[model samples]
Target: MVVILGGSLAAACAAPGSGNAQPTAAASSAPALSSAPTCGTEPVTMKGYFETGFPIAKALTDEFTKQHPNVTFDIREDQFAVITQNAPRVLADDPPDLMRLPQVSELVKNNLLKNLDEYAKVFGWDKWPPSQLQQMRMAPGGAVRGEGSLYAMGLNFSMTGVFYNKKLAAQIGMTTPPATLADLDAAMAKAKEAGLAPIAQFNGGATGGLAFPLQDLMASYGPAAPINDWIFQKPGATIDTPTNLQATQHLEKWIKAGYFWKDVNAVDYATMMSRFMKGDGLFMFNGDWESGNLDKQMPGDVGFFLMPPVQAGGKQAAMSAPLTFGVGANAKNADCAATFLDWVATDTQARTIGVQIGGSHPMGPADAPMPPIAPGTVTESTLAAGAKIAEDNGSMDFIANATGAIYAKSWTPNLQKLVGGEQTPEGLLKSVQADYVSQVKGG
Candidate 1:
């Protein structure tokens, strides 16, 4: 049974049912093949619009083409903000077979995305762990999330945490993951004193990445239920609470202490990752989606840990949710598109690609076999961290996902101001809460 929080949603790994048995195969053994039907041998070209700076989708599509040579992909890429703004127009005017999704409530309310429940049954997706798809379900008209018809699916389930450079960590005499928030601060201070960037974060562009760490801090300071309530648009939900204020103040302190890059307001996501990989910073607040890339670029130089809780031995939390994707309401190749999505979780090769290249756990039945991950790589660490989150029941959806425009409009500018010393922690929460209210009321 899924553990409900805030009377609305479940933790990322918690879902609505039990008795779903796991596959008994070991990691090294070939996965049991699904009996589901494929998209057939018809010649088809799937149109796709994907988020930029992630190669996992492209890699998956390429492999799918290799297996089903008659089906090819015509894909386009854009930054997250661009995709968020363009999703409506593009989905209504010229729809793609599949597209990376952001804040899906508005789209569902607009009837711009296909209802995927039928596809779910066709592909046996209903048999998978329900929590894996819970976030994607919504009521008709998008008034509520976490319950209703399924509309989207994840390429993989991802979790966010602190990823550190092992060499830089050693320089700070940090050999193990920080045990608490204070310990993490001490380590960051040491890195700063050692002439290293403490936190290599991206707060620039319309999609401010600072929300990543801020939300993680919120979880570290308090329970994740309120945050999820706000994101899911539960009645009477608000982000400007005492606990969140404390979380925001903590982030503000980090900003004022020079832990973050001096020019963080000008650095975009790609630039942040590039800088972090170049060993310019001791740690980065990011998701497991980058695990494969970091393992490839840094080898064993990187390590991962959850956002340490405020007190020692306290439960840990992070923004853990699916890397969501959906079919357009008017998609020409809807059946094939869905077949591809189901293949992502059920096919052995596709699951391996998701783990090795996507750096995320494939979304499927509880018993699905995970591809082998080398013992010391960041990917392995992140996967282990995901399991820890499951045990602690401390997973959250990204706070920027609270509303369709919340990230680009409220969080980004407000955070940019916080970085520039123009916004107070109190004011930041107030401004964002106001924007969230306005958007939710369709003002």
Candidate 2:
């Protein structure tokens, strides 16, 4: 009855999760949102590639077409693992008109994307928030703040939180979602003792489901030095320190205890979610964006709780990387594409996609009145304003973004071993650090 990872839908009409408050109050005078794009007469065919099979991606395609009736659109969807893994090959062969990428600066550093700062100005881009502009800065070797010329625009962002079932919790004698790290540990133990699979994770998406958050927690409790060092390029950085040791040590405890799915890292996306949606796994952790997808998958039984802090101040924080983080530098229809991505910020696009699919808005509240999976389910936005949260909570960049994603790509195998108790966290950390350092030195 138990297998992979999962969660619920955001009911917020405007907010990201349960639709609460705007992260940054825009100056109410930003043109009341664009009057929806209207360019049917001069339609241009644009090819766009992004993460695979979701309502938002499809909604984006539909909404863009609605305003630009004449434009023939070519949309490509795939997993981040595949596309980023084959970034060079994809760019060289088809050279799509536009691409959805992470860390636009990386593209600029590699000279793969075109700079859109000037064009952004002509498009009245300043009306957009500063927090949004940070993605496009033109700084070099910026391991921190993702500095580089603005070559990308994130459609919206999602954060990590706990997804649980209240009904099931009560059945298992565990009440609400666990709030503290120790609470989490206790809840997992209870679920297992009750013969219910407690924490469900898809190991195949290890880079996201595991590696990304584990490292973020490492930054939360231990030295901000290693994480901060990546951004500021601190000297003599080492992951083999106490910070990583502590993070990995805690993780091993859970791994050994059957808190997460065995061979979780080995599970594929389809199987993982399929089992999860069936209520097989008691809790799952992921971005609020999954609200829509999870709603479709599991309906009424799903709910989200902020990522519990590892320590006292660590509660309700997120471990996240923005979705749809890029635009093609040499995009033939750069102007149109840039404007479209930017509009996604204020427009009803994210909400609409989430609404139809039962998701959380990337930046807005999840108060939208939508059909529920069960008679009584929480339909709230799971997303908070990405920019604001990053600043207030201290954001950490994934190693993949640094060192050109080599570690992100290689992490799954090692993590699978770690979670399975085949590799010690210390051992895994040492090898990864050594390999990363060698690569960085060569540069």
lDDT of every model, 2 decimals: 0.86, 0.58
Give the C-alpha lDDT of model 2.
0.58
> Residue-wise lDDT of candidate 1 within 1-443, one digit each (tens)?
34456445533457733333321223112123445446788899899999998888999999999999999999999987789889977887788899999878987876778887767776788898676787898876689787788889999999899999999999889999999999999999999999999999999888688898899889988898778888888889999999999999999999999999999999998899999999999989999888888888999999999999989999988788998999887778877888899889888999998998788988898788889889988889899887788778777788887777788899999999999999999999999999999999982
Best lDDT goes to which candidate?
1
RMSD of 2: 13.6
Worst 10 residues of 1 by lDDT: 22-31
TM-scores for every candidate against the unseen true structure: 0.86, 0.75
Q: After best superposition, candidate 2 residue 372: deviation in angstroms?
A: 14
Off by over 4 Å in 2: 1-41, 76-79, 90-94, 102-106, 119-138, 141-145, 204-209, 219-238, 311-316, 349-351, 354-360, 363-381, 384-391, 394-400, 405-409
| Candidate 2 per-residue C-alpha lDDT over 1-443 given as tens digits, one digit per residue, 9 for 90 to 100 | 12222223223234542332211212111223333332336768877886775556667667777866776678878877677766645654455656767544344545555555554555555555444354345564433344444555555554555678665688777766555677777887888998888877776754535664576457545644356455323457666777678888887787788877777877765675777777788877555556666666666667766545566455233445445445543446655665566555546654455444524434322332333333333335354323335455444445555556445545666777787678888888887777767755654
